[model samples]
Target chain A: MANILGTNIISSLGFTTEENFQTVKSGISGVKHYDAGTFGLPEAFMASLIDKEKLNDSFSELSIKNSYTGLEKAAILSVFDANKQANIDLSSGKVLFIFSSTKGNVHLLENAVSEQVCLWYSAKQISRFFGNRNTPVVVSNACISGACAQIAAIRALESRKYDNAIVVGADFLSKFIISGFQSFKALSPELCKPFDKDRKGLNLGEAAATVIFGKQNNSRIQLKRGAIRNDANHISAPSRTGEGSYRALKNILQNIDKGQIAFINAHGTATPYNDAMETQAIVRAGLADVPVNSLKAFFGHTLGAAGVLESIILMKALYGNLVLKSLNFSKQNFENKINISTENHFSDKKYFIKLLSGFGGINAALLFEKR
Target chain B: MNFKNSAELTELYRSLQIYYPKFFKMDNLSKLGFLAAEHIFNACTDLQSAPDCTPITSRREPVEPREDIAVICFNRSASLDIDTQYQKTIQDNDNYFPSPSLFVYTLPNIAAGEIAIRNKFLGETSFYVTEEFDAGQMVETVENAFSDTSINAVLLAWIECFERKVEVFMCLVDRNSKKSCIFTEENLKYLAINIKFA
Candidate 1:
């Protein structure tokens, strides 16, 4: 069994996991309109930007010269928390680092191309900062990279390849991401309303999340079974019948009792197709009655970081018995009858499943049981 | 599974051309994967009985709707477009003008995607980035693919494409067979020795 040593969150809403939970539990969202003139965001006003100055101050030596500053800070905090919780010396353990991000310091690359920077470093910069010289794996599988990285870490641990694996998913809002979303016509001008009948599209957000998985005697959570499957149906679109997601769900449900699963964190990107597809998958999994919530409304769509950030939030909820309300979810869609939590409902249940689907027909699902 | 030296590779390619002439003319990575896949396809012909004269493609058709046949491809080095991105970044004064064409090849799994697209094999595709080629990971990935009964075969390819040169080694694994053909340490040693003289 692999235990989550600890997790950290760095986003516009909160810097630490505790702060994020408090804000999300109270249904407080940090998504707002930006002047764009300040960051040269063009006409796009809405975004979730972390405090760069604060991040720089906290990680002075780490250097916040790029958009990955928040990600670096989040990684440090997560490792620190995990080290503290596990009470083990990381210097002695075999550290396998897996960095997940769709946009890896692309702003730095942009700046470098513009003659503002010197080099275009990859995601290895984060692992190098943590003194992890071992070959770090960079997973840039678009949006689902975060969850895919987690599943990869779990498999590596289970295979006895490494004693501990640090899985990090981080992505920040950039002109490239914004432009891509615009190209796809997937950005919402207004706040995102996941599962709501009137939901238009996803509101982009930025954040970095890190989770440490280790084999230990005392673990707060146990990663039971996980699966990564592809839809193979469409490259940029989700399956209309949710076959890929349903298969992934079925793979996870086969090992564990579906009724024991207390809460499900749906991918619910607030996009019509994604929400509808995930809803259908949930219903087909016979989890139609299970309480489900989407964190996109709280943090907007963090893209690559969505899976790890949401999983970390669910971990906190499982530890503290806190069920965060799904913000902006009012009315249900006709596709599924799942209970959408609009108010915080604490539960003592142990097992929670997190699901994510991304571009290229990649679908991944993970099950975490409280210890 | 063992590999041949340059001479052996030439022979293997010649042998493969007899069966798949179109694929043999492609890039080295494509040729390697095609060669390995042909071996597996030929091996599975007996168990999955069809007319002896039937073409391999006809026999390899998907029988089940949910059948899983994943391809996990790994490549460490950058593609030819890496130089293009670098040149653009240098010439344009560091403005983020990453060539979308180049960026698509930045990830290693695109090679597998190309193969899958060409073959019409709709299955799970994953790309893993490692500092160096790892036999353990290759075995693990093949094992994971085989663990699922639906996944009949996995096309495991390790390719490195850079400005200097391109090197690729690919093999196909099926759960039903215990025979080892390519990518084994013994084969690597044999190829290394042969290539040292070649």
Candidate 2:
């Protein structure tokens, strides 16, 4: 198992991981009514938008070229944090970069059409910025991209392909993404309420989060076991039986005891199909009694960034010995009995699992333990 | 896993071109995927008997949706349709009815979809996009697939579709072969060397 030295988060909640943790501890809601005149999205008010120009000014002049200012800064900060704990040099040693995002400057497309200026190019641009010319992987598995990115990084590390890996998951609000989600009727007009009986839909948010994984230094968290499985049942819809999600949980449990998992960070999108499917999967995994919380209420749905964004929060919770409430939960939706948090509290257990499901029936589960 | 000759390889490419002309032109990822699928189909003549032909059929046999057959594709350039979709949306006053032409190709793994729908082999399908292709990850994917007794064969390819050009190297690997011979960086280079560019 590779050790997670540290995690850094840059989101609408706050710029740094510490700041974001403080916000989470205080139960501060980062979501707000978005009113950008330039985009002409007045109806879409609630969102978690980062100050792009402000973030760019904080970095070197060369880093501000593309729309990856937030992602670049987050990566540098995470690497810096990891470097402080471990005795490793990134320049001399190989570092596998696994980046997850849904829209890598998809906003750039509205202005012009060029193959050189797409999301994959942006990933290369980041790699070049960090002087990492080795193998860099960009994962875009829709909503599950972030979790999938972590799984890929872990596999790379276990394969001994690199000494350490820098995993980043970032996505920003763009007219392209906003319009797409709205067209699908997946966007919420008001604040998102996960697991709530009256929950309407998700409020789109943007964030960039970075986590460094390597040999266990003095880090507090360790990624024990993880698994990614496909439902193979539907393209846009999740398996009604939650068979895929259940398989992921079952696979992870095969290596580790099911009771060892203290909490669960679910892919609670506040959608009818997604939430119901996840609930059924939890029941099938026999984790119905576990305490689970959905972070989408606070961060909205960051899509590709959700995995890292939620993971960062989970790390902070483990570090601070706290389990934040599920934000908005009125009553249980179905017969599947599971403990959903409605208040901010801490837990004694150290191990937890993060689950994510996306389009094409893609499902992934990651197990994390405090070092 | 080993190819007999370059002529056989050219025939595989020709088959892919005939099936998906638009995708073949869009980038090298699709072209390579098409080629790889054709090679795997031709190599495993016995498994080709059980086809689940549906609306997405391209060949006579339906590609079985079992654990034994897996489609693993890698790409450096992610989405090729985002640019086209963005242009159409902006020009059409951002009216946001997704361009089906662009949306159809937005998925990096739709090449697997094309192959699955055509071949009707619905097994384990996975798509990975890396900054550059990693030999270790490719080998790991193969190892994982082979761990399953049901997955006797695996189709692996490294496909890149960027700018206007496409480059692909695909192969079929089974328990019989100690290592992959059809799809390696060296074999791909060999195939590239044999191409007579006018």
Candidate 2 residue lDDT tens string, A50-78: 77776675555434455444555655544
Tens digits of per-residue lDDT, candidate 1, A201-297, equal: 8888888887888887577787776776776565467887777788888887875777777788998888988988888888888898888899988
What is each candidate's DockQ, to 2 decimals? 0.17, 0.24
Q: What is the TM-score of chain A alone in each candidate?
A: 0.92, 0.93
Task: Point out where model 2 deviates above 4 Å.
Answer: A36-45, A60-87, B1-70, B90-96, B99-105, B110-125, B130-154, B159-169, B175-185, B188-198
Error of 1 at B51 (Å): 19
Question: Which candidate comes out best when scored by TM-score?
Answer: 2
Error of 2 at A358 (Å): 0.7
Worst-scoring 10-residue span by lDDT in model 1 chain A: A112-121
| Highest DockQ model number | 2
Q: Per-residue lDDT tens digits of candidate 1, residues B92-174?
A: 32353434434433333445544554454555667665545656555665665554445666667666554444556655555
What C-alpha lDDT values do all the predictions have? 0.66, 0.67
